[model samples]
Target chain A: MKIHGSISKTASFRTTNAVFIGRSIRLSLRNAEALIMAIMLPVMLMLLFTYVFGGSIDPSGNYVNYVVPGIILLCAGFGSSSTGVDVAHDMTNGIIDRFRTMPIQSLSVVTGHVVASLARNLLATAVVIGVALLVGFRPSANALEWLAAIGVISLFILTITWLFAAIGLVAGSPSAASGYGFILLFLPYLSSAFVPTSSMPSWLQGVAEHQPITPVIETIRGLLTGTPIHDSAWWAVGWCALILLLAILWSIVSFNRKAGRR
Target chain B: MRGNVIEVKGLRKKFGHQIVLDGIDLAVPTGTVYALLGPNGAGKTTLINIMSTLVAPDEGSVKIAGYDIVTDKNMVKRSISLTGQFAAVDEMLTGEENLRMICRLSGLTVAESNVRTVELLQHFDLTAAARKSVKTYSGGMRRRLDIAISLVISRPVLFLDEPTTGLDTISRRALWKIIDQLKERGITVFLTTQYLEEADQLADIITVIDEGRVVATGTAKELKSRVGGEVIELFNDKDDLIRTVSTTGSIHDIRQKLNELASIVSPELRVNIRKPSMDDVFLALTAKEMERSLS
Candidate 1:
């Protein structure tokens, strides 16, 4: 049959991506128990750190207020890695080869991974946010500021998710993809997540002070507390932009590599 | 409609130092099944992978449905679907959802996708198991679902890489029937198989590839013809047989000598002139290669 030609190229691409992303979301939702298990890890971490260790950390406020933003970032990092795992599983099962021969937009592959990652991270982020409120981690900011904070965090989730998806595409096995998540978990701890930078040793503090993640955390923390703009906010925005750009470039290159396009 | 739909010339691929495909050429016509038969490590899969645009050839040009696979990759990809030997269904999805996913990937709208999914499920006889998760499906069921998923897109050209490799007899026959139906619909099928019987049953054209090169190409009849027609299998005791043949003065030599003398002679020890089969053809081709190597 002669398929419709009236659909514009952009529309076709967008539609294809939406369909694939929608499929991934459906599959994930169907396995909601496993998904909830994924979310519970970060939620448990938030509870443990905020309530048990709340008094020991001197963050000039309740420990939940100090650690909740970091936990939210942790949720994003942990949850986004599932994209890689799922892609790896697809590769192992030969589903990727099936897609390779079809006429679908190549961008749909990336979009599917990113969208699914965002959806999953959003759920985990929601759970963390909910638990934070229950534990007295209310943000003093207005609604718009809270939205901005969530926006930046989601963007961070998206950028990192795409990067990990690419990694999973080239990974030799599913185990490799899941195991790689541990590498990303170490980044946030080195940032201003748990304690103030001054509390760390000088050399370690220097390393932590200049890392890209510290600014992201600080920016979210600032927005939550309704603090004014600081030099760190500019640095945070720069880091996020750089990460987003690099992730996109890397993903495109890796996709072409996987398909042997070049 | 029977003209060549896929044409490859001088295709070559190398992985580091090992060559996979070496200067291969092929032509597969529309509305027919073309079987590329080869043993393992013979570059059959690599050639299919290249033709399907899954891998780039180091040197060569390929055209599918008149579109260049490299420059017009998207267009070429649009006209084809591949179902690999392994099942490609998503384990988390039901059998029906897997086919629907492929329909969506092929740019079908939601309503269209559902229609196509139902059509494919019914065609593959998976309607009863449509709602069962693929993770719970049997091996044969999953294989059928995989083929069904590829067809959900309903492209004009399909590549089946050993579609029946591990299937049971009944499932294999079912798949063959489905493939026959596809050919009746004028879809060009490019398949690779180790099963000589499968090739004989399905291929309108057969290309025998070995050691990264095309050893022969023809209809089953033409390839079988290469093995010659007459045979004399004497079953006397070894020495007695030799003595009898010697006393009989070598019928083949006698026939050849008589032909040179412009006379016809018929050999008499109950000679058989049976048509050669595909196995005979394969042996002849490989035997010729062995002789060439030895010389």
Candidate 2:
């Protein structure tokens, strides 16, 4: 794969893709009611869990601290469903064909959807975190660790968003994108997210131990607890990297197939 | 040979066992409106898709604005825009936002996008409903907005696949005027239409496709001339009128004396010499295709 052209040309593709993604984010924000509604889901989840389920979970010390990171990660993961919906809406509405004929980069369309989800995810995450602090949740780690935590979660959300966008492209309708959302919500619940896997059934424990969500939740938990970083962080990063790569590959393949038929 | 902006040679496409376009060739010169006339499922959309670079050909090559569609895709895309049979516009966004987004996609800067959006809104006469969400707009308004978005990039070549499919007479004429203005700016317009008068009004050349192959290609007059100089339907009292018509060499037994005459003219002294319309030629060509297939 010769990238082709001079340095300026390479820079131009990145610039064009970024601008396109920025426009998508603006459009997403313009729908104020929908944006607010989407953000409310994660915040509501945090509040409900802290008030209702926090007493039962045993994670040493305050349950809010242990539960907050998991909820934030859940927000990042499930928040991407709307991105899939947007892409599906574009497909059903006949907008994708117009983009196919343009001079824009191939990845720009998927990136725009992913970035739009990222922007919304981050906003929702911030609202959830702020609400968490208000109700008594604090990280023992320093500023650098907090930033690192954010970086990991952002990457996680972006990767999942791309996968959902691909699923959205293949989905029959916008509402079906939310059907995938249910499966996303199941991951955090089944993993060692809100509770210890020791309390789970012997058969269920196998699932909680091996699922990708376990490592991700454990890694974020380790970071906020200021515990000595474990191999789980590396495992979480590796799993995210693999999923992102597969999703990127699948997106390009589906895009090409759609393009061929046009 | 005549500074053609689009040249398609032996183009072909297929979906599994179904062949869509089979060895069809066409050339459209710069600043000319070439109307591809076909009935439903006649592969007109497939041809436009291939030419617009939305779809790739199974065989043959397409050149648009002197750029090969496959090898020079970006350059080809830079010079052309397509409005397919379905008007593609975002219902959530206002008509103006749709146009502005297209400008941005075309690589216009922020300031340039604003200017282009305003210009397109005014040109499409969509300025009044510019702020209205497209979901609230009428079908005509949405269709008009779709076309206006295509122009924001100001490409030299434009493809419209049945632009006036389900429009009222008034809306159809409005679209025609916009197309005429585009041609005045020296844009090469390639369109496909089922409405015969549309091709008659707009096309410099018309190509008829049937069963995914070019059955006929020429100017409207050239094609019409092929059937006959004039068709005289007589309501004569004479039972021997058939003989009277047959002697003139212009009247062939269309129902029975089925020799295909390339061109016909009545040699009668009082011959009515009215030129045939494109509609008549199209009907004849498609009828022949049906007849051939049935046999």
Interface RMSD of the predictions, in order shown? 4.3, 8.2
DockQ of candidate 2 against the true complex: 0.27
Q: Top lDDT: which candidate number?
A: 2
TM-score of model number 1: 0.88
RMSD versus native structure for model 2: 6.2
Candidate 2 structure quality by residue, lDDT tens digits, A1-262? 0111111111257666876687678778777777887778778888888877776664354788878878887888767878788777776655667777777775586788898888888888889889989988977878887888888888889888988988877777888877875687678889888887888999999999888888888887777777555688888999999999998898787777776242
Tens-place lDDT digits, model 1, residues A2-101: 2222111122776777777887788778867768867998899888887677766744547888888788888888788888877766666677777777
C-alpha local distance difference test of each model: 0.78, 0.78
Top model by DockQ, which number? 1
Chain B TM-score of candidate number 1: 0.85
- Tens-place lDDT digits, model 2, residues B209-229: 998989898888788777765
